[model samples]
Target: MNTFIKSARVLSDGQLPKSGTIYPVLFMISISHLLNDMMQSLIPAVYPLLKEKFGFTFAQIGIITLVFQMTSSILQPFIGRLADRRPKPYSLAIGMCFTLVGLLTLSVASGFVPILVAVGLIGWGSSVFHPESSRVAQCASGGRKGLAQSIFQVGGNAGSAVGPLLAALIIIPFGQSAIGWFALVAVLAVLILVKIGNWYKRQLILATGKSAVSSEAVHGLTRRKIHTALFILAVLVFSKYFYLACMSNYFTFFLIDKFGISVQSSQYCLFAFLAASAVGTVVGGPLGDRFGRKYVIWGSILGAAPFTLMLPYTNLVCTILLAIIIGLIISSAFSAILVYATDLMPGKVGMIAGVFFGLMFGLGGIGSAFFGWLADRTSIEFIFQISTLLPLLGIITGLLPNIESKREVLNK
Candidate 1:
């Protein structure tokens, strides 16, 4: 852990990193991520109840997703850039406050418009949360960035997996008002983030007072090459998240329509898929570090193609199994991709995280809205059939320049 910090000899803006991976800070932030995303995931987990309570059409459902995702997507880059210019250690706690209010509002929301407003506020909180937290993860990486990112990402994935199950137990039966109970989660995240903020502030103080000792690692790629790589990464994100959006938002409807399962059962299946994804997230980073991120990115995205294509035609048990397989295979790409991009563009971890995460949310919104419109015209199964083809876009992974070799040379 201390190796990377010493070798990179720089964090960002001339800030020197501490000598080793800060396990306490990393685990603390992971806990905060779990609490944060667990609350956010509740929004989608409660969609069935919302649809029944409000008699919402598929299009309206899509619009709700759009509102939430767009709000989450749009502000991240700006916030990240601002943090890059001026690191705001305490902003994390402040952001969670929005989530708390949003939860209370969602609990009492009686109309569709109110629900939209509530989700929008929660999205605002997420926009602030992701990029800053990603920055924190990298800061504490001690140079094992892929491992650090995986640890950080797995928390959110685990929280995502748990959210639907919690909703099944708590909200599905108790009704929407039970959502207010999760405000306690937001409050807990805030307290944890405040402690993280103090640690971050102290790190900044220590680093800022030091004299310049070293510079960032150079990847030796030209500007044009770097830009082209970034564009490919964006396309890969689009492919990954767009397919994920369909599954996360509509897979429940598909299961209910096709198999006549109860909403609670469908939520359980969703939890299984998300749980597999969390497990997959754990391996992606260290694997990338051990092998090469390029191969991991390529295989992670493209590897799921067969299972996804086979999913729509399967029996209930088979479908559930296929979804879990697909989740595990495809979910590994983002960590490798993010860490790789940061490697390509050294010293811009926050901005890179913001762009990719924002693209993730934005593309997810567009994809959900598109699939909802398509499902209304055709059928849920039909949309899944079409959406399954999206992973084919992973073939474009071939276009990403191989920078891992360069990184190896630098390490040597």
Candidate 2:
């Protein structure tokens, strides 16, 4: 026990140390992220079951997501800023406990109100979790920010893919009651986070002051240029995540209505797209490191347009194939865009991560709610037809100033 404590202190504070791409720590956090997001993914994964069980309208479903998202999205930036001032390493474990309770409560919830409460609890946990975890990944990165983010995000993407598959395999058959069993995953994550927290705590004590926002202000940018880049990044995030919201929340319905597929089968298709997204995420970061983030941003967001345009018109097999293509192509933008933004505002890592991630959730919530209303007024098919146009806004990518060359100069 003494050895364990001593080792923990050393590893956490300074022994292992942040150097060149700490794989072990990176992978540990990545796995924790997988567990964290896998649990989150369950919310959407069981939507078909939730709708049927509750006699919910599409709009109600949208509201459910909004509540969850608003609770999760709004708090991130503030918490991120606070964490920058005072590091709370153990907060990660405490956050997971919220999820554990929320999952258990969801298992037993009988009505819409209780369901909201449960999901809201989960969302609050998420709001606390992401900013800190993102910082942890960056701390562990040594210097490979893009690769670390990719590795971290791939875990989330994989978890997002797996959650639906798990829901289809486990929860769908056993009913919502089965969600209780997943609390074990939360427990497991807490254990991992406990160790990570100890390390983080030691780092805080030792930190003469290494924070997530070391490079908060870029070297050669005007305030106006910074704001312009940030706004552009936000627009790009809106385009990406909103389109994603349509699929993540409503794709099952689209498949059910159009192809007459089983809930399980539709989930399998969504899993395929999410899995492709994971692959894209893994590729994008490394590619950006080798190439340039701007090129990656342009290619990822714009290159996906053709497939997005084709999705609404395709048959079932073609639709599934188009989805995979779109996921693969478009999914690459996030890490690239995020890293680019971080480069733009190096000093505000926690704040920037929180803002972008929060926007990802917030925009997704709005999109889900909007599309849900649209679906009720028109059709799920119609919503897809309209959503396909969003990626066209990627043309604005051209307006982004070339920062990669600037970064290389700074590195020299």
Candidate 3:
């Protein structure tokens, strides 16, 4: 009896601490991640309203998205380099400031030109956060890359889910003007958090007795690997953006035009898709750690392909379920991809994330324009069909020799 009790106590003790100690670093990463996601998700909720108010043609909307993406993409490599050299928290705070300013500007803007400018600023601000925050999170995770990244990414998904819903709640009754007030409040909140994060980082440095100028921990990859990885990553980015842009640029039209759904209902579907993505992000990281990152990523790609194909043919219930599934697969795949890219770059997590997140999302804007053109020439159905194949390509690429294996080959 005593032996049995002792064994049970041991098992309980092990499980208890596992459930008890929420890692503070993970919490911090999650908060920053949420902020980033919120910024990205907020735009779509207001985009349809903007189009009506501004009299934007499809092409014009494409251009606005393009400008925002291109500017942010252009800035990512530089921002990433800075994050590697400077304090990451400082970089994150700077990015937040840009977001705050952009939101404030957006709230007040009346003209198309000013709105474009505000979007660009917001994009640029968002561009900086991922690389720096990701690097810090990766460092803090002590090799639990998948779990840590997922936790960090879940925050973004949460933000994304909330941003659109919150925007809808505000804009539905109060009109677009309410968005400005919300932005003002959000900006103030972010500013306070940024200050707290900065101070906390300083405290960590002091506690560790480490100088601020520690040498870069990740280095020594060959140029060939770097180029190859970047090439593959760029393709993934393009494919990702292609699908994202199509959905973001046209999902509303697809719903209203094809299905006879109300505008509000379509918006709600978009929110549903994002909310599911957040859930997926939470699941993806841990799954990636337990399974191989490569396996989890490839599986997501394969899973997403079918959903994409089904989306155009489905009714409302099926479409929403598919959207949620797609969100899960894409968010999970991307989170794993982000962690994989950071692993490839090692000490250069910030730079890799900048390229992957910022450049990819930005480039997606360009892809969105192309999709818009495609929609103009052909039907939206064709656009959806073509976009569906992208994930298949990703699945194929992921099957190629692993990055680690490639590194070994290069070293030989």
Clashes of each: 0, 6, 3
What's model 1's TM-score? 0.96
1-412 in candidate 3: lDDT tens per residue? 3332232222211111122323676677687678666765667677778888888776777777887777667778777766555544565676777877787787778988998898888888777777666665665565577787888888877887887777767775576666666565446546645764664354334324222222222335566765676577667666666787787667777777778887677777888888887888878778877765667777776668878888878787897888888987887877777876665655566677777877677767888788777777887777876787777667555533365444445558
Tell me how far the alpha carbon of residue 329 in candidate 1 is from the true structure, in angstroms, after superposition: 1.0
Give a tens-digit lDDT track for model 2, residues 1-412: 3333333323321122445667877898889889999999999898889999999999999999998888889999987765554557788899889999999999999999999999999998889888888878877777678898899999999999999999999999999999999999999999999988886666555543333223334448898998998999999999999999999999999999988999999999999999999889998988888898888988988899899999988899999999999889988899888888877876456778889999999999999999999999999999999999889888898998888887678879
Instruction: For candidate 3, give the lDDT.
Output: 0.68
| lDDT score for residue 284 of model 3 | 77
* Residue pairs with backbone overlap in model 3: 33-156, 34-155, 218-347
Candidate 1 residues 271-352, lDDT tens each?
9999999899998999999998989999999999989999999899999999999889998999999999888877777788
Q: What value does the lDDT take at residue 283 in candidate 2?
A: 88
Question: Which stretch of 10 consecutive residues in model 1 shows the poorest summed lDDT?
Answer: 1-10
The per-model lDDT (C-alpha) reads 0.88, 0.85, 0.68
Q: Estimate the overall C-alpha local distance difference test score of candidate 2.
A: 0.85
TM-score ranking, high to low: 1, 2, 3
